[model samples]
Target chain A: MKRILIINPNSSEEMTRDIQDFATLYAENEAEVVTAKIEDAPKFIETYQDEAQAAPGMTRLIQKNQKHYDGFLVACHSDPNLDLMKEISHKPVVGIGESSMHSACLLGDRFTVISATTGSIPNKEALARKYNLGKQLTSVRPLDSVTGAVDKLDLCERVSRDAIDEDGAEVIVLGCADLVGTSFELQGRIGLPVVDGIASGLSTLLGFINQALFISKVRRYGGHV
Target chain B: MKRILIINPNSSEEMTRDIQDFATLYAENEAEVVTAKIEDAPKFIETYQDEAQAAPGMTRLIQKNQKHYDGFLVACHSDPNLDLMKEISHKPVVGIGESSMHSACLLGDRFTVISATTGSIPNKEALARKYNLGKQLTSVRPLDSVTGAVDKLDLCERVSRDAIDEDGAEVIVLGCADLVGTSFELQGRIGLPVVDGIASGLSTLLGFINQALFISKVRRYGGHV
Candidate 1:
């Protein structure tokens, strides 16, 4: 099995558990995933203030565990510390936010991110710009304050239609780990691909693992030695 | 000087001369550029049928002259045989469509593509998908046939603003070789980055050349033969 590490940039054990469960449930047989939470990170990241506070904590986590993992996944939706972590780590690192955007782009001509708050829009925009995904973004819609705080099942139908009928979002990116398995309901309503970022990241990590294995095989065969 | 070849994939000698003049006028002092037109191809590419007719001719041009060029620019905005050419050529090859979309994504938080005809909208959307650029695209707008062909200057201004103001396109991509140098007026009008695909392709090619040089130097000096 290819050993991979998934780092949740926040200290929330609940969020860490969400990502861990999803990775464990979906990762291919050839893959093994481990999850870690940054002990010093903020509880919730609904704004840039939270993002800035979370970045250094993530940096420290990767710094401590860089050598043990074959590949890394930054599990936060904002992809905090992505560039800095990539510069320091020898292995391939895939950020959940970037992988979701790439996966969504692959599935459709355009997609819009539907997130929890308006405050996080700029952060989403920043992530889009950093990963060269600014062109495929259709619209960024925030769940109204009432909708964001209420039970997700109550709001699922409304969110799906708004993403498709109003914004013309051909692919729907569930930008939060909290909505992990809501794809069936939402996609049924929207009649388009509803991408779960956490799942997409795990799948992308598998591809990277295969790439690393191919490189190792080439080296063993004396092709590059 | 770095030698670059810009190939106009269609039989339009008029368009070929226009692209050659633009490259000669703007390319850096360290870069030398030459332009060639495929003598047998379509007149105007407003639909997928035109692209299908033109692609084989472009493949022939690249096959015959791939060895001498250090880098290549596909001057046609439709980018008829770009990927096939990349598969066969040793040098870095950039399609104006892909290069401009990539550059526009880097320059701004969002972009919109404006094309000359409604039939070409799907073609632009397909280009975005092929390059994995659909995520950054704000919208694809089409200029009505009468306005596009008869009112040339007015057509450019209207298309630029429609992308920026109405569609939330922070970077405007001029979608055709016929739109060359129109980015200047568009940038002035839109008050944001307006990318001329031809120029963007040239800039990206220069970057590829520099990277190749650096890799060559590293292989020679940092390793044993």
Candidate 2:
């Protein structure tokens, strides 16, 4: 059986548990899913500075654990330092933000990401630009909630519906790993395809695991390696 | 030293050479890229009937050669019989159409596919819908070219420009495998991201090879495997 390492890239144990549970449940009988987090990282990754601060810890974690895992999934919606992580690791390292956006593009013509706060919108937009999904992205709607807050479900559903109606969003992506299990309910309420970044990341990692695939180190980093 | 079998699905040796050359060039030192085609299939797959006719021969090719290769790529942009091919094979089976569409999604917000003929538009639309990129698709523009015709470059450039100017296409995907090697020129002329399906397919296959990844059999076929 394949083993996947899911790095939360944050210090929050609660968020780590949520990511682990979601990955383990979906990965049932396909592979073993394990979750880890940097002890020195921020409790929440909400800003560019937060992401920058968390990068070193996340990189160290991957370097330390790359040998035991078949593939790696970075569980943050921002996908902090994904390129650098992939460059150094021997395994296939996928970012949740990248995987969900790619999966959303496959699922719909335009997608809206529901973020944890309005402050997160700019970073998400930058990511869309980096991935070349800027035009395909309808908008980034904020839930105005802290990580692991289940009470924002109604607000999320309402904002998502508005995104579909006003922004012409054909799909919705839950942009925070903390919002792992909310996609199904949000999709049901909003009547659009809802993607959880954590699930998409796990599924992508599983695909790599089932095939024993990895990033071509020779072609990566300007083919200098 | 992974090997990828690129099956053109059609019987045209010229098209096969084009695919093999593209895959081999871009794959440089990454994997061994091999190309094949169905001996009795149509010269070009432009319709549902054509795809259906080619399916059996493609299936036979995969079944016979599945053991020698690390992965398989269906070289046709229509991704003929991709599901069935994946079902029967032990390795990752990616279709050029799927790979191009997925890659286009990563490189741009909205994309237009340039087809060989107007008759191929409906089929390309169906593929977009099948992959859930229907809404993200700006339009499907036809080149009005017969298969293997080099004279349609001007027409392709014109239609792609219109797609960018009028249809709001952020990316251009050459919808026919025969149109390989036209992307760089088209990108220069049209000022939009131009994606060549064959190259994208090979790159995706190489990523899987580097990681040894494949589709999870248990999840691929209604969880019956």
Candidate 3:
């Protein structure tokens, strides 16, 4: 069996464990699913500054384990430092954001991303364009109800429902790695596919490993490893 | 079983049959793959003029059969009338070009397209950009060597080799519907993933059918059918 290493950029062990449980369950005997996070990184990666601060530790982790794993998944919805990760690894590095968006595009014409905050909306939209999924994205709705009024999970469900009724989203993407465990429950309530980056990322990387697909190392991804 | 209508958009019964055979084989009990072509369309879809000429017949066919098929696959690599078709149909319409590029993105970082003529290069590049896959595209190489000296299949092999060596392509997308049957043989020789849009499109539509995923019927795809 092949091995795939999934990295959550934040230093939150709780979130990392949640991602691991979700990944292991979704992967389900396809391959061994291993999860890790940047120990020196922020507990919460809510800003561009946090992404930058997380980069060095994340890069070191990827470089150290790139050869040990058949593939890597940068399991963050913002896909922090994804291109740089790909450049340094010979293995296929599937970003959670790209996987979620691309999988949603395959399953539906349009998808709405439910984010942790309004600040992450532009980041998701820009990544969607970069990945060629801009047209398929309906909108990015953030869970701004962080005032401890509604349960966070309930807020996600409400935002997803609104996105479906108003934004015409045929699919929903969980835009934060910490929300990785809510996909199935949310999909059931919203009556649309709710994509989790961790699940889709693992599934995509497994496909690549099955097909023996790797990053192009001739120019853009060359010389860094 | 779910039915997917794959339209060739050309007046060549032979090519339509070729696509049908390939689709039927690849689909393999997942979904019923039905293939057709415009009786009034050009014998070949080599130029934009050909696509324009083929549009009406293709549109009529899709409109007539939209209710019968659970999904649709626009089999030509140019994906002629794709947006219009989506606007008209409630079911999901999977474009071959879109499928090929998106699947390649999921599998690898970069892909090269093999087109039938130099005239189609711009079309493919533009489509790639429109699909947000322009950056992942290494380059488009046309089979302008239709000088009748070498075999067409051999020309494809040589072009693909050049693309891998010079363009740093990790994957190859056959850019014309006519090239659909050549993917496996070419992949064998090239030792890289050569994506046949028909197969990927069929696979994609089947996934949608299984998930009960449809085009969002609220706004962009609302009230068309």
Candidate 4:
């Protein structure tokens, strides 16, 4: 069986657990899932500074255990240090953010991303364009949370409903790592395909393994072995 | 079982047969595969004029059999008159081109489209950008065909190798309907993920069916219903 290591680039143990559970369920005996979090990293990767701070810790963990895992998945929606991970590890690497976006296009004609902060909205849009994915992304709607963190399923449901009714979003992508299992219930309520990053990323990585599809070492990632 | 109608806009009955056999195998008894080709249409959809010529016939086919199929798949990589079909048919409609591009994002980072003629290359590139799909489209390379058609798997193998070595294409998409079932053998020869639209599009359609994911009728497609 292929082994997938999910590196959650945050200090939140609860978030790590949530990511792990969802990935394990998604793998469904097809692959083994190993999840970890950077204890010294920030509680949440909401800012560019947070992503920068979490990079070194994730690099160390990946370098130490790269051989044990067949594939590597960066669990945060921002995909902190994803290029570094891909360059260093010869195995296939995918970010939860990219995975969710790619899966969104497959699920529907147009999709909206529900993110934790409005600050993240631009970054989410830019990331998709940069990767040349999420061409069908209609909008990235921010959850109007008082705490400015991903906290409630009710809020995701409401925001997703708006995205559907207002943004012409046929699919809803939960753009925070903390919102892993909320997709199932949210989709049921909305009557549309609602996807989260962790499950989507894991499934994409598994598909890569199933087909013997690996990262191209031709030019962009040729710096590594 | 969910029934998917593959509308081959081209008049090539042999190409339609190839699509049917492959989609049935990929569906794996999960969905019923029904295939049709417009006999009055052009033999190949290599030019914009051909796409325009075939639009009326495909539109009539979808209109007549709209309720008979669970999802509708336009069988050419160019995805001729796709928006029109979606506007007319309320059920999910996907172009094989759109499906291949979305699936490529899942399989690899960078992909190259191996088209039959040099003339169709620009159209393929534009379609991906228009759909906001295939952000990682490294290049669209043409087969050096004397007949200016999709023929000979050997030519596909050679061009795919060049795409990987020269263009950094980790995945090779056989960007023509006639190239169905050619991916497996091509991947074996090149040691990379080689994908075709017919199977890729069918699997994506099935994923939509599995999730009960339908098109957004709130705004852009709201004119019909």
Candidate 5:
């Protein structure tokens, strides 16, 4: 079976557990999933500074586990240090933010990302621009809560409704890794396609491994070998 | 190694050869790429009616080969009978148009499809809407040549330039399967990301097989055992 290492850039044990549980459930039969947390990193990555600080820890985790894992998934929606990880590791490395947004593009035309807090808006927008999805991205709406609280579902629903009715969004992307497994439920409530970045990341990574597809050394990851 | 059957939905022997050569070269040492053509299909499918006429032959090919191939790639960028094939086949089935469009979304933001002729413009537009990419799709510009003539590259370059300038298109998708393997050359001249649907289809299909990811029967293909 393929071994997949899911790295949560933040230091939150709760978030790491949530991601591990979700990955285990989905890939139970086909692949072995191992989830790790960056112990020294910030508990919540809501700002660019937090992401920057967390990068080294995430990078260390990837470097240590690169030989053991068949693939690496940067579970954080912002995908901190993804390019660096891909450059250093010979194995396939996938980012939740990139996979989720790309999957959203396939599911619908206009997609809005539901982030954890207002502070995350800029990072999300920057990611959209990095992927050249500025036009397809309808908006990046925040839920204003860092914790993945059940109570926030109502607020998320309200924001999602607005995105659909007002912003003309046909798809909703759960921009936080903590929001894994909530997509199917939210899709039912919101009456639109909902995407979970964790799931998308895992799925995309699995595809890369199954197909023996890797980041082209000559193209995307040059000069690193 | 995985076996991938690339079904050219058109009858043109030359087009089949082109697809076979491209798939074989790219997927070498990883997957066995097989290309087959529908002998009764039109030499060129520029309209919905032509696509319709070709469906039965393509369907028959899928039914006969479903048991042998590990995955199926509908070679036509129009992805005729895609839903039906997915419903009936147990193995993973991918459409070139869908794969290419999804890959383009990841490579860049907004994209324009370059078609074989003006007659294909309406069909391409309809596909963009079906994929919910009406906004992300800048336009479907034709090479204005049905014969796959090399002279049309200049026209393609000019139209692609206009798409970048006027439509702000960051990626260009070769809408026809015959345009496979030309993206790299075109990207150099156009100074933007260019996508070949054939390569995208094979890559995506390999991902599906590697990950064991499939269109959930409970969701996409209900009641079909």
Candidate 6:
């Protein structure tokens, strides 16, 4: 079985557990997926300062564990240490933000990102620029919810739907890792593909590993070598 | 100086000259830009059979020439042999379709792609899926121009503006390499960021190389034999 190391660059073990459970459900017999949170990483990264603080801790974790795993996934919507980690590791590494945003494009004709904060919107835009997905993005909307950093799960479902109906978002990406399992009910309500970044990252990880295995077999037959 | 090897995977010497002239204009003073066309490669690949015939020729060229360049750019809008070439080349390789469409997202809130043939809409979609930019795309429309696959420079300005106005395209991307040098003027008329894929690819190459250089610098600071 292929092994995937998912690093949540925050101190919230509860959020880490939530993502781990979801990965366990979907990873199937195809792979053995392991999820861990950095003990020294910050809790609730709400600012660029928080993200900056969290990067070195996450990079340290990736450096230590990268060789043992087939791939590494950074489990933050902001894609906290994407460039730094991709540089250090030879294995395919994907951030939850990059993977989910990519998946949202496949599932919908257009997409609107429902991020945690207004400050995070610029962070997302920078990501869009880095990955070159800014044009595919309709808008990066901030839902006016302040208290739910990691505890509460409440937001305007209607506003998100309007983004789909009026603003032309065929897919809704829940831009928080803590938003792992909550989006399915929203998908049921909105009647459009609402994506959880954690699940999408896991699915993409599995796809990448399976693709690598398939290519390895083909290379054994005098291909791509 | 950063070195870019821009390869026109066709036998058209005229197109090669056009691309070389275009690349020279935008490339930085610290960059060395050069171009070559496959003398034995197919001319004007307009259909799948033509593309299929051309892929091997292009692959042969990549195998022969990829070693000397820091970056490789396939100077065709169709982006023939894109994935296969990336798998083969150790250096950062980009195709105009891959680079421009990916770059389009960086320039605006939403964008639409205008290709040369009706069949290419699906081709564009496939590229979107491959690169994970499907969500940011407004639409991929084709201009059923019977002649001059993408060099209809005069018509591009008018059609591209219409696409931006009618389709809510905040950014306009010149989808074909033949439209490369002309997008800046069209952007002036359209009043949005216009992306020529060649420029986009060149920029992306620099971005990737810069990241690689940073990583290499970090590596060099540590103990090395």
| Number of the predicted model whose TM-score against the real structure is largest | 4
Model 4 deviation from the true structure expressed as Cα RMSD, one decimal place = 4.0
True contacts preserved, each candidate?
0.01, 0.01, 0.24, 0.23, 0.07, 0.03
Candidate 2, lDDT over the whole model: 0.77
Candidate 1 residue-pair clash tally: 10
Q: What tens digits encode model 4's per-residue C-alpha lDDT throughout A1-81?
A: 779888999999898998888778777656889899998899989778998899899889888987898998999998778
DockQ of each: 0.02, 0.06, 0.26, 0.29, 0.12, 0.03
Candidate 2 lDDT, A13-63, residue by residue in tens: 999998888778877766798999978789999887888888888888888
lDDT of 2 at A62: 84
Indicate whether candidate 3 or candidate 4 has the larger DockQ: 4
User: Is 4 or 5 the stronger prediction by lDDT?
Assistant: 4
Model 3 residue B128 distance off true place after TM-score fit, in angstroms: 3.1
Looking at model 4, residue B219 earns an lDDT score of 54
Each candidate structure's TM-score, on Cα atoms with residue i matched to residue i, is 0.51, 0.58, 0.77, 0.81, 0.64, 0.50
TM-score of chain B of 1: 0.87
Question: What's the best-to-worst order under TM-score?
Answer: 4, 3, 5, 2, 1, 6
Model 5 stretches with alpha carbons more than 4 Å out: A145-150, B1-8, B11-40, B43-74, B78-94, B98-101, B104-225
Residue A61: error of model 5 in Å? 1.8
Docking class of 6: incorrect
Candidate 1 clashing pairs?
A: A134-B136, A135-B135, A135-B136, A135-B137, A136-B134, A136-B135, A136-B136, A136-B137, A137-B135, A137-B136
For candidate 1, the iRMS in Å is 21.5
Top model number, DockQ: 4
How good is the docking of model 3, as DockQ?
0.26
The residue-by-residue lDDT of candidate 1 on B1-225, one tens digit each, is: 888999887788788888888888767564799998877678677666776777787777777777777888888777876656665555667778876775554334467887867888888898887676777787887767435345655786777666656776666777888777666666565565567878877765664464231111111112232
Deviation (Å) of B26 in candidate 1: 1.5
List, residue by residue over B77-131, the lDDT tens digit for candidate 6.
Answer: 7777765666566566767776666445433446678786777778777776666
Give the per-residue lDDT digits (tens) of candidate 2, residues B62-173. 8898899999988899888887887787777778898788766544457899988899898899988776678767899987743454566777888887787788787788
Q: Model 1 TM-score? A: 0.51
